[model samples]
Target chain A: DVKVTQSSRYLVKRTGEKVFLECVQDMDHENMFWYRQDPGLGLRLIYFSYDVKMKEKGDIPEGYSVSREKKERFSLILESASTNQTSMYLCASSFASGSTDTQYFGPGTRLTVL
Target chain B: AQTVTQSQPEMSVQEAETVTLSCTYDTSENNYYLFWYKQPPSRQMILVIRQEAYKQQNATENRFSVNFQKAAKSFSLKISDSQLGDTAMYFCAFMKHYITGTASKLTFGTGTRLQVTL
Candidate 1:
């Protein structure tokens, strides 16, 4: 079985504060992704990393960035946390060999910005 | 760009019954992948089932099965003898097939919330 774990399950931050959400996978997958899930809007990709030090902007990349210094770890960074950034954040990983591979997800982190 | 649509926002069904969730996608790509993901109250998303556009046969996993229509671009999930554990938010996703080593993104629908009642 594949295991994807996040650093925090819930977080609270003040406006303009810096926030970091960490994700780690044990399956040694080459692709990692960060997504923001909102009601009625579903899950929207924020950023993804294909390999170490290689990152790509997804559909909604503004106000967020990501880091993939190692194969097992992927971090999502908020430059300046705002109230609008409060939402459930999910991390996923999958094998890079085929697009048909299933992406395993971690229990999401619900961030609250005050 | 690909878009997945799940018109049903909320659905309810009795335990030990059957329920079907509808999903439709709009994409020009002939070869792609479709998936149904279940997000329970625990907030952990799990893959329920998947269907490849190239395969005419529908995909099934235990009590979970999918109805895939290529030309109609419709993919629906049917759960037989639904249990309380089946209550969750179901999301339909679309991904374009790429060559090996190419990272592909999944376009997800605004999930349908299912509540299994007694």
Candidate 2:
């Protein structure tokens, strides 16, 4: 089974604080993605890494950055957290463009910025 | 940019009943993949079913199936004999098919909240 685990299931932070969300996958997938889920907008991609040290900005990349130092781990960083940044963050992993086209998602982290 | 639209915001059905959720996408690419993802309360999201655009036959997984219309750029999910466990947020997603190593990003609909009541 492909297991994608997030560091925290819930988080609380103050405004202007730096936050980090970690994700790890056991399937050795080459693609890792970070997405934020909002009520009306659904899940919007923040960033994705295709390989180690290679990252690409998704539709909503502002105020966020990602790190992929290794194949199994991907990290999402919030430079300056704001109240509007409070949303459910989800991590996903998938095999590099192959027969397996589906992405396995981690239990999301709901962050609250006060 | 590809856009996926799920016009239904919420839906309810009794147990043992059937429900179909609608999804429409705007894209120019002919070769791509469409997916239905289910996210239950407090649990991680999971792929319910996926249909490749090039494949004429609809993809089915047990009680879950999809109606894919390539020309119309529409894809919908139908759950037969809906159960309580089927209650969740259903999101329709699109991803361009690629043979290379880099996987394409998935564009998702706003999601339809489904409730399977007694």
Candidate 3:
């Protein structure tokens, strides 16, 4: 079984603070992704990394960035945390090959910005 | 761009019964993939079932199955003998086939929240 673990399950930060959400996968998958999930809007992609040091912006990448220094770890960074950034964040990883590969997800981190 | 739609916001069913969740997607790509994901209260989202656009046969996993219609671009999930553990938010996602280097991003629908009752 594939295991994806996040650094924090819940976090609270003040406005204008910097926040980091970390994700690690044990399956050695080459593709990792960061997504923000909000009520009635579902999950929207924030950023994704295909390989080490290679990152791509997804649908909603504003005010957020990602780091993939190693294959197992992917980190999401918020330049300046705002109240609007409070939401559940999810990390997923999958094989680099075909679309049929399943993207295993980590238990999400619910961030609260006050 | 692809868009997935799940019109049902909330649904309820009794335990040991069957329930179906509807999903529709708009996309021009002929070859793509569709998925149903279940997120429990624990917040760990897991894949329920998947269907390939080119395949005529619907995909099934244990008690979970999908009704895929290519022409209408509809994909719905049917769960038989629903249990209390089946209560969760179900999301329908669409992914277009891409080249090797590009990572496929999923376009998800606003999920349907299912509640199982006695």
Candidate 4:
């Protein structure tokens, strides 16, 4: 089974505080993604890394950045958490190709910016 | 860019009954893939079913199935014998066919909140 784990299930941060959401995937997939889920807004892509040290911005990349120093680990950073940034964050990984290339998601991190 | 839309914001079904969730998308690409993903409460989101645009047959897994209509740009998910465990948020997603260099990122809908009642 593919397992994707996040660093935190829930996090609370005050405005202007820097926060990090870590994600680790057991499967050796080449692609990893970050997304935020908001009520009525659905899941919007934040950023994705195709390979270690290579990242691409998604639809909503503002106020967020990502790091992929290692293949198994991907980290999402909030330079300065704002109240509007409060939402559930999801991480996913997938093989670059093949029939089973569909992305597998983590349980998610619910971040609250106070 | 591709976009997905889930018209139903909320849906309720009685136990053992069947329910279908609607999804529509806009894409210019000829070859792509459509997926139905289930996110149960705090649980990890998972793929329920998938349909390839090139294939005419609908995809199914156990009680979960998809009705894919290429001409209409619609892909709907039907859940049979609905159980309490089936209650969750269902998202419709679209992905362009895999290219060697480009990332096959999924574009998701706003999602349908499904509730299974007795």
Candidate 5:
């Protein structure tokens, strides 16, 4: 079974503070993603990494960035946390394209910005 | 951009009953994958079932199944013999094929909240 784990299940930060959310996968999948889930808005992608040091902006990438220094780890960084950034963040991992593979998600981290 | 829509916001069914969750998507691509994901109170996303757009037959996983209407671009999930454990926020997603060594991104629906009562 593919297991994806997030670093923190809950986090609180003040406005303008930088925050980091970490995600790791045991399956060595090549693709990792970060998404912020909101009611009525659905899960919107923030960022995604296809390989080490390679990253792409998803639909909603403002005020957020990602890091993939290694194959097993992906990190999401909030450049300047704001109250609007408070939402449930989810991490997911999957095999590279052409496999008809599904993304395996981690237990989400509910971040609160004060 | 591909879009997924779950028109129903909430649904309820009694134990041993069946319920269906509706999903619709709009995309220009002909080849892709559709999925139903369940996120319980634990907030862990679990894959319930999947259907390929090219396949004419519907996909099923035990008590979970999908009615895939290709031409209409509608995919709905059906859960049979609902249990307490079946209560969750169910999301429908779509994935387009990416290039070699690249990642395929999934666009998810707004989610339907399912409640199973006695």
Candidate 6:
């Protein structure tokens, strides 16, 4: 079975603080994604990487950046945390092949910004 | 641009019963994929079922199945003999890829909250 592990299950940060969310996958998938999930908005993509050091912006990438220094790890960085950035963060990994590749998701990190 | 829609916000079903969740999507491409993902209280998203737009027959996984209507651009999930563990927030997703065979992306729906009761 494919597993995607997130570093934190829950986090709390003050406004204007820097925050990092780490994600790792054991499957060595070529594609990794970061998404923030809100109550009524569902899950919106933040950023995605197809290979190491290659990243692309998704639907809502403002105020967020991502790092993929290695194939197994992907990190989401908030330049400066704000109350609006408080939400559940999810990481997913998948094979960067045809359109049919199903993404495997990690247990999300619920971040709270105060 | 492609967009997915889940109109039902909440649904309830008694244990050992059946329930259906509706999803619709708009896309100009003829080939694409649809998926039903379940997120439990633990916040872990699980792939429940998937259907390819090119396939005419519906897709099924154990007790979970999808009713895919290509003409209407609708894909609905049906859970039979609902179990307590089936209670979760179900999201419908659409996926398309670049011609290079890389850069596959997913567009998600608003999700439907499903509750199972006795």
The interface root-mean-square deviation of each model, in the order shown, is: 1.7, 1.5, 1.2, 1.2, 1.6, 2.0
Which portions of model 1 show Cα errors greater than 4 Å? none
Mark the regions of model 2 whose C-alpha exceeds 4 Å error after superposition. Answer: B99-101
| Tens-digit lDDT string for candidate 6 (B45-100) | 99999888888999999999999999999999999999999999999999974446
Question: Pairing residues by index, what is the TM-score of model 2?
Answer: 0.98
lDDT of 1 by residue, B1-118 (tens): 8899999999999999999999999999998899999999977999999888899999999999999989999999999999999999999999898655457889999999999999
Per-residue alpha-carbon lDDT of candidate 6 for residues A57-105, written as tens digits (9 for 90 to 100)? 9999999999999999999999899999989999999987675589999
TM-score of 5: 0.98
Better of 1 and 3 by DockQ: 3
**Docking model 4 quality class:** medium
Candidate 4 C-alpha lDDT tens digits along B1-115: 8989999999999999999999999999998999999999878899888888999989989999988999999999999999999999999999988888757999999999999
- lDDT per residue for candidate 5 within B1-118, as digits (tens), equals 8999999999999999999999999999999999999999877998898888888999999999999998899999999999999999999999986667668899999999999999
- Among all windows of 10 consecutive residues in model 2 chain A, the one with the lowest summed lDDT is A93-102
- The fraction of correct interface contacts reproduced by each prediction comes to 0.77, 0.75, 0.84, 0.68, 0.80, 0.64
- Give the chain B TM-score for each candidate: 0.96, 0.97, 0.97, 0.98, 0.96, 0.96
Docking quality tier of model 1: medium
Predict model 3's lDDT versus the native: 0.94
- Model 2 clash pairs are none
Candidate 6 contains a number of clashing pairs equal to 0
| Lowest lDDT block of 10, candidate 3 chain B | B96-105
Please identify model 5 stretches exceeding 4 Å from their true place: none
Scored against the native two-chain complex, candidate 6 gets a DockQ of 0.65
Give the Å shift of residue B76 in candidate 1: 0.5
